[model samples]
Target: MSWANILKQYEQEFKEAEVNSYTELPDGKYTVKVETARLKESKNQGIPMLAWEFVVVDGEYEGRHEWKYSLIMPERMQWLKQDLFSAGLELEELHRLEEELPSLLDRLLEIKIETKMSKNGKEYRNVYIQKVVDRTPSQKPENPFSPNNPFADDGKPINISDDDLPF
Candidate 1:
């Protein structure tokens, strides 16, 4: 689709009935709430997505919408988390199915909404109606005690005594 139409469509979907609020993202780690959706082809099975939708809920571009990402369900969302972080968002700020996403998505699957954005390159959004599966990380068994240094477990932080030195 043409960028003109694409932009216009997003403008409508994200329109706040004609109101916009902006906030500056301070320089630091942050969590920006996002709304996501996914879509798939009617004829394809177990096939990768046709696209996805992602919406920003805060900051300068609050209410901005994207509908051209490649994310079809039933699919995993770990990568989505990564991409969101890359796009200046964190899971700390999320609303799933419009009901607070981070926790909700961790517990159940929600149908998401997304829109396609490009003709050639891959750029899309998880429309508000896309599907999201439980994406919480599993808790690993804790060791009896903390190691001296995590890096030392890999030997990088290990000290080399005089004889151990590879000089």
Candidate 2:
């Protein structure tokens, strides 16, 4: 149930069903300000590639106003090209979408984590959802978001799109 696990173990396999099917950024995407984004470049069985990231969109963030950017494997421009075309978007628009990607992409996975041991085994870190729960609150109101907030934790599960939510 931790993002650390998912990133360390299942990222590649899980991506097959996701990256292929999902090739565009949504209209209103965003990421938190405090959190930073990272990128990794690699050769996929001799194929060059890159990973663009917009980090920390699922926590008590800086109000969805920022996003980190990276161009992993620029050698593999096809991925980015296809994604932009699908969305009818441009490269700069990718950053705009990055800010909102975590929330939108969240709907595609359940809990967004797959636990696994790290190269130097010690403690398990979250790699998918990163942190499922954000204990700290950057912005708090006089009245806490009780059972009436849009994201209120009601007894029954809230309805979301199966196409975009977690497993």
For candidate 2, lDDT tens digit of each residue in 75-141?
A: 6356555543332334554445455433333221111323457788864423222222332324445
- Candidate 1, superposed: residue stretches over 4 Å from native: 1-32, 42-47, 71-167
**For residues 1-167, what per-residue lDDT tens digits would candidate 1 score against the true structure?**
98998788678567667665653322222122334434344455555443434444445654554444544343546655554444333457434322322332212223334345688977554423233333443345544233445445653445557996588
Model 2 — which ten-residue stretch has the worst lDDT? 104-113
- Every candidate's lDDT: 0.42, 0.38
List candidate 2 stretches off by more than 4 Å: 1-38, 43-75, 84-92, 95-100, 109-167
Per TM-score, the best of the predicted structures is 1
Give residue 45's error in model 2 in angstroms. 13
